[model samples]
Target chain A: MFNWKLLKTIYLYDGTLNGLFTIAFDCYIFKSIPSNIIFEDNYISNFLDTAIYIKTDNEKSSRIWNGLYNNVSYDTLYNCYYAFLSCQKNKEINILKYILKAFIDGPKINTMLHIDYVLEVMKLRKNVLHESHRLKGLTRLSEINKNLFYASIHPDNNVIELLGHFFIKRFPLQNLILHDKNRNLLFLYNSQNPNNYEIISSPSNFNISNYSIEEIEFQNLWKTFFKNISIKERTNPRLQMQYMPKKYWQNLTELK
Target chain B: MDIQEKLEILSDAAKYDASCSSSGSNRKNSSNGIGNGDISGICHSWGADGRCISLLKILMTNCCMYDCKYCINRRTNAVPRATFTPREIADLTIGFYKRNYIEGLFLSSAVIKSADYTTELMIQAITILRNEYNFHGYIHAKTIPGSSQELIDQLGKLVDRMSVNIELPSNDSLKLLAPDKSKLDIVKPMSYISNKLENNQRLLSTFSKKRNFSLSPVTKYQKEKFVPAGQTTQMIIGATPETDLKIIKLSESLYNTMKLKRVYYSAYVSINKDSCLPTLDKPPLLRENRLYQADWLLRFYGFHADELLEEKHPNFNTFLDPKCDWALRNIDKFPVEINKASYSMLLRVPGIGVISAKRIITARRSFSLNFENLKKLGVVLKRARYFITCNGKYFDKISSFNPSFINENLLMLEKRSTPSKNNYSQLSLFENSLPTKGDVIKCLTGNF
Candidate 1:
């Protein structure tokens, strides 16, 4: 007979949601108890049970990821990642474990609405969706050159991947680079050429001189235009600060 | 007068007019013009004050024949008057557009000669921008009441947007203050534009059926469409003895009856010391902001003016935002279960905005949301705490708290004193510390 306390073993894995799912799958398949579990890299465990480092296999991870994608809605995959990115607490792991178990049980799992964990995951996903939409309107781009549109965003979440769909659709013909300087990532889309992107840990030094004289002239012209429009009679510094916060102005070319 | 001096005087005189928004129209560059209205335009620069400076928002002339009590450029005032010729004004617009100095021109005028004459000059300036200069950008023209319907119709086709200021809410107030203006004259031009737009739309839709071939690529009906961005009117708040409820109701009627794109409320700043008007120490800016918030609720939040401020509670609570005030009044609707509530129900909560409400709706489709998860989703629990519950579990509440008590508590919380600066010596360290002559020039011209 298994002692419930002794049988319970805490599983720790990489902080990624995929790593969490693999740990959950191993515990379930082997009939081993998950006493108190956490993302392996986050905190040191106090449990005396045996520690196992469950490696994240690309094939198995892709199989789980792709299975969720093909069987479930894009929203489900998005929510799972959103909940994963939240870095909330151990509950997030349990939620992910429930999702994996349902997926392992086959396509029928998508129909169930009784699970509270699924709802919480969807909430996190909705937040990421809202942020992506806001970025479309609020992402103020500066003209670096005639062909290049440069914008730097310091988003609270990893929304760099999400913004690409909007930029691609809006400025289809223009060559642009949307740099997530916080994440050190770039999405380069050139109109005359096919679209291709790469994750660079350290991008080469940028030179402002590479911009055309016309582009530089237009930038100055735009700045001049912005300066002239403010009405002195209705100057409300309080309202101005509210709309265009001081922290955002640091990156805005017009503010400079 | 030379164009430069005339421009300076006219632009300075036009400064008092607060309707400078250049959004809504999505006109693009055609074969006829060098400019494109697709871009957000030059007035994108916001000042230290909340006003957006996009257009060279100036009048064609400030030499008015009428003596409106609320007007700074009224005939009685001893301010220098100037008028810009159509050619000079047209040249200024094109030059400014080329330099990216302004998005376009907001050409308003005082009753310089006659209503017809002033309207003619404004039309002439816009015609040059459209036909001669081939500049296709955002132009917001003011329709002078009593101008010919033909002139109004002609001008409507050329400009992107137009406005007819209702200056005062009631006709009685109009007679008391701006005696020269009449409600019929104001409503007449708006009716003409609305009819023209309706007629143009009907003509375009019918043309597709009339022709044996597919829809015409270039229809005359499209060019004749009146004010593509529609009309907006301004009302002077706190100028007359009208209550806040009266003003909001007027705005609602203007939106519903007039089908206005926007109704700008210019807080009465006491620019002119006329015996008829109130002598306020400062402009009721906070009140204006509250009115704007209420206006936003009316437009976006499916709220009526009466719901926010009733006949008894005519004035909005100065301390709390309009939404919070509304929520406090309806305390019986409090502690709405987040998981079970509808999208509209979630939106009614004080702390939850449109975005957060939408998130709650979509998220609850899959899971029952709790308090901690709601906070993570960026819901303002401080204000919403009294209103919403997570899975039927209440977090915070003063059980016996009445609306007045909540109002007082919220008012105390809202009392934020702007950090006082001690010394003029620290001024140099900050950017835009003092408005220099250069800063004024840049603010005026969109050139820094």
Candidate 2:
């Protein structure tokens, strides 16, 4: 009578907010929880005997997002987007499970920390927010050209967009580009229109070594300041490495 | 001297000042200015010693007339001397700031000729940065101890924070080590700045329209022109014979009476071999860390200095943090119910930090929390389990309600909890080249 395989088909899609939302929209229409949901890049051939590729539909995804805003709390919808940005495996399925639970449990589900999935979303959001906050201090801008600053970062999470608020607020009149080398994305902020920031695909090769004369001089001064500030008696490399991890020293002006 | 050489000596000399923070001020940039002083200061980088490099911390000059024996730049020392003109200081700050190199300027100086002259030079440096350069960045300038009332008054209006180093713990220590500096010279400026800040707030609330922060004679009744982020001071510990009781009491008094924002405790850094000072192998950094923790208790937690240490227990327990040590002595306060305890009570419990206590209060409003929920709320259950309960169920099996019993377990836990100073995780100079996606995923989750 009943076939378990038919109902348990898992779906994988291209990794984007639109792609995840489309899958959620399908699950909502079907009124059934799939076996799993994941990104297409992470899809592994499994014995479940079914794999569906869902093309990203902008209209369908927008409908799902609007439906979420109308039904669930705005925080839950926002948290879903941020959680998807996490590079963690199972993050997509986790968000899907949260969405499915929210659809069944009602709008107040976001406030319930005792629920495991809701707590996981909160944890992942904190990780992303912490990295974004740390980068505000760690990012070192080098003036590559006349009045154009270039900074490169290889953050664990995709936090290029999140760093826009801090740099823009601090340098509203300066041209800045924050290039995320790992993810091949660039956040460009033009001084003329400081209100908006555009994200674009980064070129395959970008040179960070070419710097203006003033920038090279500033880097030297910064390096001098960095070298002299430490006390000779207290040489705790462990303590130094504990706070400013070694992995982040690659593009740091003082470290380089 | 070249700018690089000047920067090296001045920052090296200024390293001992220990007030590198750029927080507590929210000065916005002028619509046409180059920068804004953030309310929550940002650290641009960490130095080799791992201390934060928030501001471009530097001395105006490293040549001093008064030979304070603890100082490296005292009159008797054989060291290279350098000084930056006010214009050079101003230009360097703005140049480095535009390239995203620093938060702002933390300008201090040795007594070049006199306290008044040094203070005036510092004021001129800040004035140039603020007016000529049109820079609106954070400025933390050191107020020379015995500067004139006019110079001090003019100085406060131009900077975000001002500090006068209370170099020693007691008047006796002041007399013994640094004969050139006096207690009144250090304290009078602190009191003046504090009173001015208080009076400024009172006047601001009382007379909103008559606010004139211009030159003193512009308005009949001068409005309060003061340091917006407030004033802080520092004292050298282990250099003097004063007990921890004296240091903590001084900090508590400074906090309550002078209304000082922060009192930095500098352990005796033995840079000079003066016959008047005792020789130490190293700076007492551990004791300094303990004092900072105790200071946090005084400021944030509802604990007084006397409560943490009495006449019999004059010093903190070196093995345990000040809070946990206090908890063990006051064993009657243990086993606090997580659901029923007040915020203050919850904060008193070890391993439940301010964030977790607030989380508990927020989460408790929804439902009665269990142990698992407490862990999810970021409570370090390994340490908190012995002290807290959920619905009258203790997560860990309890021994007798004995002080020594709990203290024994805590001492063992303390040894295990702290990341070993020698064996912390290391990142070699170039161990990681390019992380794959799986490694990126782990790192994103805070595992890598």
Best by TM-score: 2
- lDDT of model 2 at residue A200? 94
lDDT per residue for candidate 2 within B106-164, as digits (tens), equals 99998988898998899888999888877778899888879998899998988889999
Report the C-alpha displacement of residue B182, candidate 2, in angstroms: 2.3
- DockQ values for all predictions? 0.15, 0.47
What is the iRMSD in Å for candidate 1? 6.7
List runs of model 2 lying over 4 Å from the truth.
A1-14, A18-35, A41-81, A96-111, B203-225, B397-400, B416-448
Cα deviation in Å at residue B345, candidate 1? 3.2
Could you tell me which 10 consecutive residues in candidate 1 chain A have the lowest summed lDDT? Answer: A1-10
Estimated TM-score for each candidate: 0.66, 0.87
Specify the highest-lDDT model's number.
2
